[model samples]
Target: MRLSRYFLPILRETPKEAEIVSHRLMLRAGLVRQQAAGIYSWLPLGQRVLSRIERIVREEQDRAGAVEILMPTIQPADLWRESGRYDDYGKEMLRIVDRHERDMLYGPTNEEMVTEIFRSYVSSYKALPLNLYHIQWKFRDEVRPRFGVMRGREFLMKDAYSFDIDEAAARISYNKMFVAYLRTFARMGLTAIPMRAETGPIGGDLSHEFLVLAETGESGVYCHKDVLDQPVPGEGFDYSGDLDAAIAPWTAYYAATEDVHDQERFEREVPEDKRLHTRGIEVGQVFYFGTKYSAPMKATVAGPDGVERPVHSGSYGVGVSRLAGAIIEASHDDDGIIWPDSVAPFAVGLINLKPVDEATSAAAEGIYERLTKAGIDVLYDDVDNRAGAKFATMDLIGLPWQVIVGPKGIASGEVEIKRRATGERETLTIDAAINRLVAG
Candidate 1:
């Protein structure tokens, strides 16, 4: 996208209400706009970043063998009543009545809705292990919504539901999601540790929350320092095979969120030198809520002997929108958000230092074409902005790389490339620059 033609509404000053770094930067960078007290309109640049994050989440879910199936954002009250959470869900559910007088609610989560979907077509143990997922928007009325998208009322979420014939089978499905979450966050350049967490309204005895430890996090967390060093499952990890061996290392260390944290136990389990007490942003969570929804909703499947029983189930969720804020919270420097290469809105920012200059424009334009043709997303700054302004914009938006084209560099048959994360600059011939970025 060329800056001149793009719709980035960059802000010169931070909004007064933005209490957190991510929230402040998001507004100033023109990634999002506040539409209401707790809702936001994701701007073009924000949409690009959000989509990239969603893609990685979907890819990892697919890699873990979950089939994609989108469900409705608004659900009938009858479904929730069947699962026994309609009234219990309280004011946060946004309960409403249709013109026809039927009750409905904007779904805060899809447990009841997914249960209905499961029972509608699935009726046999032959389909015992089925994991269905979707990337969609969800709404929950937080009384005080703050921190931009990090704690927004209406936000995007990637929620996956799994069904199995028994508790043992359900745990296996849970482990698959566990490994998938590890890869999802790792690919986004985050160190999200899976810690023991309360199930809360999700209704499960076995649950884990993936926390990206940062001082600015909302939840206080206690963990062993080594959990940060645990290796994430590789791309070649076999999802069909037993995952216990792969999961052992991650679960071997001690980690727990504040709700489930035990200070005495934390002291006993981890050595004093290895103990870590910090706050964490919850990015994702997995729950093995065996038959919680299925039993109440009659979502049962017939076993080998033709006797029907409730399907054991689990739910895994990733905060698709909140991740943008979380990534910024974890990775940003004083300049701006240091986007990880995998989730950057654009892979490269091509800066035309003097777009009004004929040679400079031609050089930058040529480089942009080459990069785009090489399957790279380049945000070319073709506007006639000053060099200082161009550099500041590049740094603020935090693209993984910046290719600076100027008359001097163009005359010397070179363009300067800057790595946004490290601010490392290298002057190379146009051909070499393209080759290096393409190879990446």
Candidate 2:
């Protein structure tokens, strides 16, 4: 992508409404533009980051054996009614009437609708242990939607629904998602701790919220320090094996959100040196709501003994769009966002420091072509902008690596390679720069 042709409306001054660093950087970096309160239009740069995050979430979900299937944003009101939550869901649910005068709603979550899908075609123990997921936009109409995409009225989410024949099977499915969430966040350069959390409107006794610790987080959390360093299940993990033992090391630690925090137990379970109290942003959650929606909606399956019973079910959710903001909150510095390589908008920023100089432009174009040919995602800043402005813009967008091309450097037969996270720079030959990045 070339900045000359990109639609990036970067702001020089911070917006007054942005109370958090991520929101301010997102605005200044021209990632997204607010259309209304808590609503935003993701610009080209923002969309690229969003797509990368979604890709990681999808890949991790697939690794955990969850099948992907997209569900609609607008859901039938009758599905919520059958689950006895249409009215109970409260004002957050955007209730509407269609042209035919039938009630409809923009789904905030998909438990009721997924249950209807499960009941429609799946009806036996043989079809048990099925998990379906989708990445789609959702709306919740927050009464006070603030903090940019972190607390937006409309957002993208990856929600996976699991169906099992019994409680034991449902727990195994929950464990699978548990490990998946760990690997997902870790891949994005986040150490998300799984903590015991209250099942709010989702209505489940068994639930865990994965939270990334940040100073500006909305929720207070308490946990053992070791939980932050615990290793996640590797790629070779067998989903068919005992997932319980796989995640036991992480769950054994004392971790809980404020809603479920037990101060006395926390102190007793963790030594004073190991105890950690901090604010954290929730990135994902897993819930085992056994027969909660299935029983009420008649989602039953025939057992091996030929008896029909309500299937046990669970729901796993990762805040797909919110992660972009949460990641900024956890990873940004005074300069701007320092994106992780796994979810960066582009792997490298090819900055032509002197676009007007024939030698510099040619060198930059050659380097850009080489990187792109090597299957790397590079954003070529071929625009005629000042060197300082170009550097600021590249840093603001936060690509992992920046290859700086200038008349002076190119004349010396070298290009400057800078690491965004560490501000480390090295002058390398064009070939060396390409080899280093390609090998990365």
Candidate 3:
């Protein structure tokens, strides 16, 4: 995409309302604009990153045998009533009435709705181990919505529901999502520590929250240092097989968020040197609530013995929108957001240092074409702007690589390539630069 013809609204000054680095950088980098207190309109750059994150989440979910199916943003209140949580969900849920005077709500979560969907068509042990997921918008009217998208009222979320005939089968489904969450976060360049957490209104006895450690995180966490270096399972991991062994490595350690933190346990379990106390931002969570909704909503499936019973169910959630801010919190430096390669809005930033110069413009245009043709997402800054401004914008947006083209460099038949994460620069021939990027 050419910056000259693109819609990147880079902010020259940081907004006063931004309390943290991630929120400030998101605003300055032209990612999202606040539509209300906690609602936002994702701009071009933000939309690109959001879409990239969604792709990674979806791919990982698919690998774990979760089938994709989109659910509606609005859900019928009767579904929540059927699950005995219509009023118990509290003020966070936005209750509404339609013209027909029927009750409805902008769903905060889809537990009850999904249970209703499950009982509608699935009725036997044959479809027992089914997992369904969707990436969709959700609304939760936070009393004090702040910190940009990190605490937004309306956000995009990926929620997967797994249905099994019994508790043992449900555990298998839970482990699939647990292992999948580890791989998913790792693929996005994040080391997420799975911590025992309260299910809150979701109401599950077995629950784990995946958190990314950051100085600017929201919750205080305690864990053994060993979890920091735990290796994630590789791509060839057998999701079809029993995952209890794979899940054991992570569960062997003690990690808990403040909601469920036990100070005495932390002291007794972890050695003084191994005890890690810090802050973390929750990126995802997995829950196994045996017959929690199924029993109440009568979502039953016939067993092999021809007895009808409530299906054991689990819900796994990945914050599709909050992760954008969380990634910035974990990765950014003083300049701006340091996007991970997998979730970068654009892989390469091509800066035309002298857009007014014919030779420089031609060289940049050629390089941009080559990079684009090489299957790289390159944002070419072919606008007639000051070099410093161009560099600042590039740094603020934080693409993985920046290719600089100018008369001096073009005269040598080369361009300067700079790695965004490290301020390392190299001058390479146009062919060499293209080859290197393509190889990467």
Candidate number of the best lDDT: 2
- TM-scores, in order shown? 0.98, 0.98, 0.99
Off by over 4 Å in 1: none
Q: Return the clash pairs for model 3, or none.
A: none
Poorly placed runs, candidate 3 (over 4 Å): none
Report model 1's TM-score to 2 decimal places. Answer: 0.98
> lDDT tens string, model 2, 1-440?
78888788879899999999999999999999999999999998899999999999999999899999999999999999999999899899999999999999999999999999999999899987899999999999999999999999999999999999999989989999999999999899998999999998899899999999998888999999998888888878788888888899999999999999999999899999999999999999999999889988999999999999999999999999999999999888888989999999899999998888999899999998899999999999999888899888888889999999999999998999999999999999999999999999
- lDDT of all the models against the reference? 0.93, 0.93, 0.93
In candidate 3, what are the lDDT values of residues 138-247, reduced to their tens digit?
Answer: 99999999999988999999999999988989999999999999999999999999999999999989999999998778889999999888889998999977688888
Where is model 1 poorest over a 10-residue stretch in terms of lDDT? Answer: 240-249
Deviating ranges (above 4 Å) for candidate 2: none
**In each prediction, how many residue pairs overlap at the backbone (N, C-alpha, C within less than 3 A)?**
0, 0, 0
Record all residue pairs in model 2 with backbone atoms less than 3 Å apart, i.e. clashing.
none
- Per-residue lDDT of 1-440 in model 1, one digit per residue for the tens? 89889998989887999999999999999999999988999999999999999999999999899999999888999998988898788788899899999999999999999889899999999987999999999999998899899888998999999999999899999999999999999999999999999999889899999999888888999999998898898989998787898888889988999999899899999999999999999999999999889998999999999999999999999999999999999888888889999999999999998878998888888999989998999999999878898888888999999999999999998999999999899999999999989987
Distance from true location, Cα of 222 in model 1, Å = 0.8
TM-score, cand. 2 vs. native: 0.98
What is the lDDT, from 0 to 100, of the residue 152 in candidate 1? Answer: 88
